[model samples]
Target: MTTNILFCGDASMTDGVLIATLSLMKQTRHPLHIFILTATLTVNGHHYRPFAAGTAERMTKLMQTQNSAHQLTRIDITDLFVADLPRANMKTMFTPYCMLRLFSDLVPELPDRVLYLDTDVVCRRPFDTFYNQSMAGVDIAGVLDHYGKWWFHHRLAWFDYLNSGVLLMSLAHIREDGLLVRCRQLVRHRWLFMPDQSALNIKAKFKRILPRKYNEQHQLKPDTVFQHFTTFFRFWPYFRIVTVKPWQIQAVHQQLGLHEYDDLLKDYRQLAPKLKEVS
Candidate 1:
């Protein structure tokens, strides 16, 4: 009865996914069945070996200490019927991976419910509490979007918009309510900064809204279970504003004031320091 966690990404986001997973593993002792939806592997198998062997070994050690274990599963995109999913031509960072999450119900051998996370998030505390909790009556549970006021649809107050980065989805409710079909319909007609995210928000907008602890974005708050890297640029402690990614070398030389997040990414750096170093 291991907890199931899902992530969707291609080569461009593999490392981010790896780091995010390691961060979660670091905080929790509960066994996890990590499901990754990806199509192509990195150019060489090189990027994957270290994460599979080295980082996985670390997880094994931690799990052993806690009397738990974990497994990794990769679901190929080509195996799914996603060839015709509607995608907006907006120049956002949207990718095919974004659309794969909509087909959560189609995932073979999946559990009744699962947690979905974006590659940019880092888990700070144990979430098996929320993961194992019942959704009550909602099909999906998520935190309210901090930037919801900027979204055109959210301004209408149709429903409280939520950031799609972290979601606790109840497959039973989704299938029962025809959520997939509705989400597909919304995706086909609407264009948002994040198409898939916007579609999910529009469809599940009235569902249960989780506490702020579940998905803290950009700003770190007390009792935060998840810390998200929504903003890449910041001017703090430094005289001038600068952009820095913890995964990038700039973090070490520039005073981006993000060292607070070092613990979240330590395993990632030690195991695979370079971009695409882990797939």
Candidate 2:
């Protein structure tokens, strides 16, 4: 069976997505059916460009190199986003593109089960075990946010708050229960700090909290499967938020001091120049 992976972002997220894809490809030999959801939107004066078709074409070719069955499909949800705009959170720190995953149920092409990953993540270990885990009654499966869990919980502070960066979604359950519809309504009408993540936490009826190894947001451990480069706060010298992504090769080497993915980084460096030509 092919693993259905999903990523949502705009054109600015191209490098992150490409590097994340490379990391996944290196870890597992399983047939991957990757779906990239992108959209063009103009909230206020800022215009966001959708993922380029040429980049998608290049990525499709790259995926097939590992396994003939591996495929990459780019789905543009411009019209859907235009119809149901998240008006309340449009001006938040996050771009409007971050809400794209909330429209996944409306996309006819998506599989019943899709693993949604944020662009700023790298796979360190094969996650077929996590991907193939039974989702019989769970609408979504995710790990607790390293930072958000302490403050953003719906009921129990640490137990209910889940990070949206790496989620194993049950699309069938979400559609049947109208989960995304409620999430969309919540974000469109109400202002949330982390709109999508908060809406999911509040509205999802059944969610499974996985081990931290599934989405290790902090320092990477030996058993970490997906290393998420999420923004975290540091208070030693002075209180400041740190943000770093896998695509930031120099930051990953210098700031993060991570050298485990040298092979993947080398491949990303070689392939990155071609993105400029495509864009």
The top-ranked prediction according to lDDT is 2
Best candidate, TM-score-wise? 2
lDDT of 2 by residue, 1-279 (tens): 888999998888888889898888887888888899998788789888888878888888878877889999999999998898889999998888889999999999999999999998999998999999999988999999888887776775346789999999999999999999999999999999888888999999899999999999998899999999988777878998888888788998997789988898899989877863353
Off by over 4 Å in 1: 40-68, 79-81, 87-93, 150-159, 232-246, 252-255, 273-279
Task: Report the error of model 2 at residue 75, Å.
Answer: 0.7
- Evaluate residue 276 in candidate 1 and report its C-alpha lDDT on the 0 to 100 scale: 40
lDDT of each: 0.67, 0.89
**Which pairs of residues clash in candidate 1, taking residues 3 or more apart in a chain or in different chains?**
none
Model 1 lDDT, full chain set:
0.67
Error of 2 at 265 (Å): 0.8
Where does candidate 2 stray beyond 4 Å?
Answer: 276-279
